[model samples]
Target: MSRVKFELPADDLTRATAFYREVFGWETQRLPFEYVLVDTDGEPVDPADADGGISPRTRFVQGPVLIIEVPDVDEVAGKVAAAGGELLNAKERVGEYGFSQYVKDSEGTVLCLWQSIADGTAAV
Candidate 1:
């Protein structure tokens, strides 16, 4: 099964959150950042599932972005442009869990590539 991380862009998170809860029956948890995680499943937000987040729409990121797990972000980051895609940012650490990068696909849809560290707790 492929692991996916998704992000939803919202102008007002509180209102958007209500919609997610009432319409989709999903719960949300707010992180330290302005980001809110949407638990599509009633269970804890498992990494194996399509864990998603919602945040205020940004200037560059106005639409939803989907993330796919990769073995090596740097390796994949190198091939984006040749594939007619654009790397929006360089790979960066997510605390001690993993690294992520945002890239725009050939048709301009922004996506993320994630590479997790097996020994997750060690800081890079």
Candidate 2:
């Protein structure tokens, strides 16, 4: 399971939901602020179980991006810069739980790096 997730941009939640529904066959459920949860088709995961659910603990940003995990954020941050992708933010610890950062690809698309409590490492 990946520690990271992606949220696509939407100008109109209902219109976007309908489009994605036809395009990907994914069911979107509304939350607050016109945000929708992209429904997964597999068995519903329970957050109470260790490896059964989405990390209810991690924070997610609202935008279309890739989620990656890595062992050390500082190391990856350097690599991102060296690779010509600009690092948008330094790694930030969210309490004792995990850390995250933002970066932009060569085309300027933003991507997020996610680290979780389980491995204390960021996902790539």
TM-score of each: 0.78, 0.52
What is candidate 2's lDDT per residue for 17-114, written digit by digit as tens?
A: 67866876665555433345565453332221112111221223345567566656777778889888988877877543457788887788787765
lDDT of 1 at 79: 85
Off by over 4 Å in 2: 1-4, 9-39, 46-62, 95-97, 119-124
Assess the local accuracy of residue 105 in candidate 2 as a C-alpha lDDT between 0 and 100: 73
TM-score of candidate 2 against the unseen true structure: 0.52
In model 2, the worst 10-residue window by lDDT is 48-57
Candidate 1 residue-wise lDDT at 89: 85
What Cα-based lDDT does every candidate model obtain? Answer: 0.77, 0.58
Model 1 gets an lDDT of 0.77
lDDT of 1 by residue, 45-104 (tens): 544343787878976568888878888887777888788899998778865457878898
The lowest-lDDT stretch of 10 consecutive residues in candidate 1 is 42-51
